[model samples]
Target chain A: MNLLKEVFMKYGYFPGCSQTGSAKEYDISLRKVIEKLGVSFDEIEDWSCCGATSAHVTNHKLSTALAMRNIMLAEQQGMENIIAPCAACYNRLIMSQFEIANHSGIRKETEELLSASFQKDVKVFNVLELFLNIGIDKIIENRKRELNDLKVACYYGCLLVRPSGLTKFDDAEQPESMEKIAEATGAKTIDWNYKVECCGAAHSIARRDIVVDLSKKILDDAKYHGANVMIVACPMCHTNLDMRQRVMKRTYPEHEDFPVLYITELIGLALGMDEKELGIDLHFIDFNYKDLVPENSGVG
Target chain B: MSVNTLKETNKLLASFVPPASFTDEEQEPLNTSVQLHRHNIADEISERTFQDVSLCYQCGKCSSGCPVRYYMDIAPNKVVRLIQLGFYEEALKSSTPWLCAGCQTCSARCPKEFDLAKFMDAVREIAIEKGIEVKEKNILKFHKAFLDQIKSHGRSYEAGLVAEYKMKTLDLLQDVDSAPGMYLKGKLAILPHNIKDRKGVKSIFKKTSGK
Candidate 1:
């Protein structure tokens, strides 16, 4: 752990559509946390969507080309590592690198499409993965404020842990990386089975019943396990858990609308970040965790 | 998944079939050509998804771990089995691949390290390519709508995505309750975010999709 000393690493941040739209709070909190930690990042200029479910499901070639464009852009910026806050984009971007590197035919196809050759130069990491590399102890030591007695259920959803060949990170079967990161902020993490469960993403609009059925179960488990706040990394997961509570409640009328915070937002709060700076007020459900933790109180 | 779960897998698969419902076409047609056809489909799968279908040994681990199994017409493991059995038409027609959430649970849980997610994704792709009608109309609409947004602006435009999706599915009032909350929370933008590489995105789709 001696190499854990604070070191400057620059990453090209590729914010998915949700980060600018549904999960803007994620972007805001990410900015605050990274700033507080003295971490520097550059937004990959002219970055495009990673073709999350659409390209992959419809046309495999289209999917690889779209991700290849973003990776090439990051490389063009002289950056070797790129990070995405959205799980869907992160999966696609990383998978794009993997696809173009291993599959010569697909790589040639993509290279022809973009009229640009893809070198196995850039690597993609989710923001959570980036922080885990930064060391959880360093994060804890950097905390300006501690969330004492705040019970949180850390939800990884999917994409962060699967298709192990591409993601190449986290235990696919039972992942505790996010839980460990959340606990570093001085919050209590509830152990739960649905940590890596699917929240029926992208189906939020078309097949909402799926999202309702799936997200409701995740929320119910988190609540049942005494979690007052839910922490997530993917913007899609955040939307299903935070924005779609009203829709989910149609099936379960008694379902309480719980606040879902991004990993960065939780880290920012633990760092004593200004509420507005973290964009905490923009949640669909009221963030009512202040009462759970005594104001300005030290670790209980 | 394992030999230990064979009893449970059989019981589950049995629940779906009516007792003694095997009709005149119900012969266990494992002929020589059928065997060739089976290997042909397996070869096609390997070429498409880069997954060795031979690695699978009828283990139902994929179906057991699938979160959306309750809604699938055939379970995740069964789709691979159907392909391995040369039932390409049956696998393509089934609602299983379309219903897949792409959660990668099946891929993660496969004991043989078979890429079930990619296999299912490839099935959906083949289904579309062959003009097989998807039983899940709304999901198809959603994917088409999502791709449409990406194709035009080189990024997703939420307002445009919703408008186009609603137009395609004709479920205008569907999930309308979440809109007000989403808009009020600043979760949606009225305009699409454009990437300067719009031509690059369009060409990528045009070249790869063969459209």
Candidate 2:
């Protein structure tokens, strides 16, 4: 009676923009880890962007319409559930669902804008929710290598459990879902303050300085709490925390290197997947897996 | 004069103080003209976002929880207060909306259940519509560049977005050192992944933009 196996046999995958570019590791590790778990994902064919923060800030209607088109596409392909790996995409999709369901004006306007019938029934899940659906026992049972040496700071960032009215999955302010999932891999999760802190998302390019400053505080907090590595689910958070470390070094001479790994990558490692196969090598900060394994573990 | 009685006397004195006169006569008069014109900013925001800005009681919870509050010219609570006070231009012209980051933390922790994040969105949209000078030009440039990428390709192209943003803001040479490393890691797609429904995407953009 493996409820996990039956729960997510298939889902519509919305990789979002970063999965193909800035966060390819998330896409790769997600696919590899899920495949090992006997789950399959059918990507929505020719899906467009979800509009993210840009459209929402500039034009609310455009944001809803953009996300609605993807939902419509998933429905057209007959998917009951969708897994948006990026937190921003998941937030936008779910926000659109909430808006369309509650506000008839928005629903009518979105339908008219896209010229498509909006059923608005498809369920959107973030990566954390996807794992929760897969069940923690399944992850613990499938672990090929214990991650005892890994001290993880589960950074939820923002958008994962926000605007509680819309997400409704976990506590918006104090999220423990990521910590629970990270601990399932035998990794010790740190109790840190900046788990739900903002990592200066979407300002990675336009305002790198702010991203650097904000990410520095998060990294500093995690390290101060004795975390050797940080685990993140959102690609934007990963970019700011991991990619911006280069600038951190230049700005603050005391800045030390810190590795940021996607939650899927952590699970992939626990499942005995290779670093290269999991795209861990693609990260900006270096991660030495040999040091984490025990001397006589006979693993890897 | 006991301390409590003195405080009450000061409060009475404060109540008698005349309103500050508009230093710049060229500036539109506050409250009086707004009342007569029936163009209340709070009502406009409420109508646009469906959020009752009147419900905000200046608790400052939104401002305190804001991650980027230090960067904002006006605090989140004060922006809502400014709207409540009918100072729409001040709220619109401030850099608060541009620096919000759309995290929804304020809206989440707000005791009044005010959707401050969506309110910020409405402020930014209205600011642009009214042709107000953007306090944070680079942020707007970045957003425009991002939207342009989506409009052309129906998806966000990081390479195209970066190039367009750099050209637009002329903040060239910023993050140049990291570009090579990102490209090497296969994180920067050289070509845009154009979707099949380009017409559909374009139409969505056109109709929403009111073009």
Candidate 3:
């Protein structure tokens, strides 16, 4: 915990909705590792939804207002940078920041709606962006253990890449940041066709069949590509792929069970934390760590 | 024109059709590419739409990544390019925007990073503005059915979405014969209701739509 305070002293955090509910493993493990690294996540006061896909669909003005509300809070809290772990939330928040900053009329209008004036004071970061910015050398220096022998596929869904100018952390068509993080953990990263394909975000709720089909394709391709585990940095993507695996198996009998993990969880496992501590127990898909991990590894 | 004398009508019609060049006694000569300007709809363009279209780079990435591109009359990329060129009426008439599933894939994969999905959405927005109804029957039925389901349940229920989708696209019900057996096996559920945030959902809809 002392180490986390040191690392997170300057970090302001935003967990978004999915991180609280479905992908809580990301929260648990992320906190665990960052705590060890002395990073503190001073959450903003009275944060609201980043207006995911719904607000954007209904009205552009409302979507900008929704994102501006949280950014205003972050700015008021005196934190210029906030880490939004979920890709969808990050995309929405950053995209809104870019829009609100560039357009004077939009900034004026949204500020009026929120009953507050706006300035371009706050910026959003996806978790990978923070990791990259903090420098991989720092993380590598802190590695207590290695995760050698795990064949991992780094899956980045829609939000991370779309509207590339806003979330300019990596290339949209071919992102290598996740793979770099995986390699830093000493895991073998696999290349696959559907790496950036949609896992059907909110479509999972309104369109289950489509989500199932999309997930089945993702899981099957990952397995066929020889990946033992799929790693995600998005909570919504993790929830749809992990929590809905049973439904997917039932819908498509050919799909075999495969574990979906948050990148933080893998980092925890590599750091020699117990499987249960990383929240791997919450996962629906069964995995045998002994076979996937090196014999000397401490994923107990 | 009588059917027996249809050849004369065909010849007359052929004369009306412009050749490589046309000469008129009173009209001025038009330049090459003038045909394109004749069909342009700049005056009918919506300024709000232009704001969205100006972001487009004519990147074919949206077309390449689109899932329903095969079924679309205009590819998603072409639709945005068309909008940028001020072919507003032609773009509105195209089936591309109406066919989008709001997947975010095109918006996700765009190299120039244009929100083709949002532009497609703006097409719907402008369509409603112009009071031009959705001409595609399947898409219309889909909107109606999903709205009916949400109107009933306050949130979209999966079973309801599926049932509505199936009803709207009659071919889906035929697949239903094989579906219920899977449903019986716990793969599907008949009743659909909001799982959580029940009242909050109604408030959300109301707040956004002014319902």
Candidate 1 lDDT by residue in tens digits, B1-211: 3332433443454455433423225634433234222234556666787766656888798898888899889877888887765556678879898888889888887778888888887888877866777889889999999999998998898889999999997889975777777788777888889988788888877787765
| Candidate 3: regions farther than 4 A off | A1-9, A291-300, B1-46, B49-61, B68-74, B78-114, B127-211
lDDT of 2 by residue, B1-211 (tens): 2334434443554355333442234456534333312345566677788767777889998899888999989999999887766567788889999999998899888887889999999999988877777989999999999999999999999999989999998888887999899999888989999999899899998998965
| lDDT scores of the candidates, listed in order | 0.80, 0.88, 0.67
- True lDDT of residue A93, candidate 1: 83
Window of ten residues with lowest summed lDDT in model 1 chain A? A1-10
Question: Comparing to the true complex, what docking class would candidate 3 get?
Answer: incorrect
Cα deviation at A174, candidate 3, in Å, is 1.4
Look at candidate 1 and tell me the lDDT of residue A123.
Answer: 73
Whole-model alpha-carbon lDDT for candidate 1 = 0.80
The TM-score of candidate 3 is 0.71
Which has the greatest TM-score?
Answer: 2
Off by over 4 Å in 2: A1-8, A293-300, B1-24, B28-38
Going through the candidates in order, their DockQ values are: 0.64, 0.72, 0.12
Model 2: docking quality category: medium
TM-score of each: 0.89, 0.92, 0.71
Q: What is residue B151's positional error in candidate 2, in angstroms?
A: 0.2
